[model samples]
Target chain A: MLWLTFILAGLATTLPRASFIVLGGRVRLPPTLQRALRYAPAAALAAIVVPDVLVVAGDFAPLNPNLAGVSAAVAAALLSRNPWLPFIAGMVALHALRWLPGG
Target chain B: MPSASFRAGAREGFLAFLPLSVGLVPWAMVTGMAMVGAGFTPVQAMGMNFIVFAGTAQLGTLPLIVAGVPLWLIVVTALALNLRFVIFSAAIAPGFRGAALPMRWFAGHLLTDGVFACCLEKMLAVDDSRWRLGYYLAPSIWSWALWQVFTLIGVFAAGVIPKHWSLEFMATIALLMLLVPLARQRPMLVAAAAAGATAVVLRGMPLRLGLIVAIAVGIGAGFAAEHWQDKEEAP
Candidate 1:
């Protein structure tokens, strides 16, 4: 059962993940579409990250991790267009907050 | 020449996993620790790493799996968490168009956050092939090795971090940081907001099925919004 599940899940995972690349340039998606595709990864990433940061202790704890993330992320987003800079800034703010009061 | 090229590519691929260690160190360790907390034997936990090959999803699903949530639910959730791989794969597809299938498979396995970003950065920045492979993947190789070792360490320290520190919260922050910069257009905005709302509404659903729903919703929303925006601008 485990093997079967793994195979099925792996196939499901690998196929969509591999679709664009496997189709290999035959899919002539517009440049605008590619630009749109760029947003999907980051957007999907946000969907997973927000709830956890915003909700603390299994309840809504807004001023805590979520604020730290959103604030620093907003800062990073605004200050630098570079990807790595904002990531580091946000991580530093979020994790370092561990030492704060009521944190 | 072919053997040399293949060998060279493999080496670069290995190097790509390296730079990712810093972030991966904590993330993977947390995952391994969670696996331990969930009752998987050490070997099984590590084995899961290779098979699933995603840090966030592993942590997300292990508890549900242990809780005896339906396998379908777990699979769906895992798939949702991993949906970014779709984006990652798509971004690099054009670059790898002329490469062989086996090469693409090998390179695709190296696709992750740090690898994707760093590789794309370096690949796009440089025009020369001489240092291209090394420059593209070395940092990521750093990340991959870091994650594996962190998983080993997290196995030990997993119990140390109290449950309430909300390390998961940090992941959320990391994600917001990752995405906010990319939300530049109407369709992207609609997709992001819709996906986020959907995820929250469906968070209570079985085995993270809400996430899958959210992903589909977000993608569809993005496509629809973009289509509408284009129509409005046209003629």
Candidate 2:
């Protein structure tokens, strides 16, 4: 079942990537759809990340360590152009928050 | 033999992508680590790396797989995360028009965000199809190789790493990293904020349906924001 899931997931991504390329000039996506697609990555990523960081064990926790870590990540992202900085900052922040005296 | 322009384009493409390749290392490793940390066997983790070849989708769907959600839902989630590729394909499809079917399929399969941006920029400057193809494939192949190698390292390393480090959170951070940049634009910002808030509020929903709902709400909010921005900008 797990293997099947991976295969299907692969197909899901591949089909879209291949959609226009293989179909050639015969078809075209509507312009409105193209504009909406720009936000798909941001929206989907936020939907995935928010629940993971903001919710702890299936409940919303506004003061969680993960929030602090993500905040640090956002700060790093804005301050530095290097993509690695945010991840490093985020992981360090998460660890620091987790290991803090009472936290 | 390929033409000189193709060779030059390939060299340019590789050099152009070299700097960006460094950033993918940590992201790929975290993805590999997250896969193993999520309880997937090393084999399964590597399989996903090769098969999906998409870091965000792999990370996005890990929790779902761990939660034992329905297969369709996992695929749908992955698809939603990958919808950006459709736009990418559409943008680049013109460059590959009239190319062989297999080559087109192969090129599309290898398409990625970094390669798309780099290749698209080069494609616009040159009219030669061969040069464009070379530019597209050079970074596409290099990035694929780099991603696989790093991800494999992470998969095996996860076996020895302590579980308490919570490495899976790295995946979330990686996703956050991807999200933050896109959020710089107003519409994208609105979309991310709306989606994130919605997902948090709906986190308790069964079958992880909240993710799908949040994505829809986010897209709607982003579209509306874009429309409003256009209206305001118009004289």
Candidate 3:
């Protein structure tokens, strides 16, 4: 069953990727729908990320080590184009925050 | 035998992807370790990586799978996380138009966020279809290879890493890197803010249904923001 789930998941991901390419000129997405689709990635990513950082054990906690780390990450990302900078900043901030006395 | 222009394009693509490959290492390793940490055997983890080839969807569905959500629900979640690829495919579809069916299908299957960005940038500057195809494939294959190699390393190293390190959080950080850049524009910023707020409010929803709702709300918010901006700009 697990393997079957993996297969179905693969199909779900690939089908959309293959949709427009395979159908070619036979199909055209409306401009409005295309613009909406452009937001899907950012929105989906935010939906996955926000709760993970803010919610702690079923409670919403505004202040936490995770939030601090993510804030450092966001700052690093804004400052530099290098993807590694933010990743390294986030990990370092996370570890440092966790090590603090009150944390 | 491929032509000289295709070969040149391929070379440029590979070189261009070299710097970006370094960033993928930690992300791929974290993903692999997360899979093993979630109770998947190394073999199972590798199988998932091979078939899925989507880091976001794989990570998004991992917790739900461990919680034993329904299979259909898992598929739906994966699909929703991957909806962005539909836009990517459409953007590059013209380059693949009229190509052989097998080639088109293969290329579409290999499409990814990094590859799409690189391919589109090069496609804008070049007019040759063959060169564009070569440009796309070279980086696509290179990144795919790098991803597999690093993921395998992580799978084996999962046992050595301490659980206290909280390595799964790295996956979240990696995602944040992807998200932060996309949120630079006002409408995108509004979209991300709306989605984040919605997810927090609905965090208690069962089966992670809040994620889907949050994405829907975010897209609507972003579209509304864009429409408003256009109206303000018009006479």
- Per-candidate TM equals 0.70, 0.79, 0.85
lDDT of each: 0.64, 0.81, 0.82
lDDT of 3 by residue, B197-231 (tens): 99899888865778778988998999999999999
Q: Per-residue lDDT of B123-215 in model 1, one digit per residue for the tens? A: 534444434544444554556566677777777776788876555544544455445545666787788888887777666776566766776
Residue B159 lDDT, candidate 1, scale 0-100: 73
- The DockQ-derived docking category for candidate 1 is acceptable
Let me know the TM-score candidate 2 reaches against the reference structure.
0.79
In angstroms, how far off is B18's CA in candidate 1? 8.5
All DockQ scores = 0.38, 0.59, 0.63
Higher-lDDT candidate of 2 and 3: 3
Q: For residues A1-103, what per-residue lDDT tens digits would candidate 2 score against the true structure?
A: 8889989999988998998888877887776775665566677778878888877877778798888888998898888877678777888999999899999
Q: Candidates sorted by lDDT, descending order?
A: 3, 2, 1
Best model number under lDDT: 3
> Could you tell me the C-alpha RMSD of candidate 3 in Å?
3.0
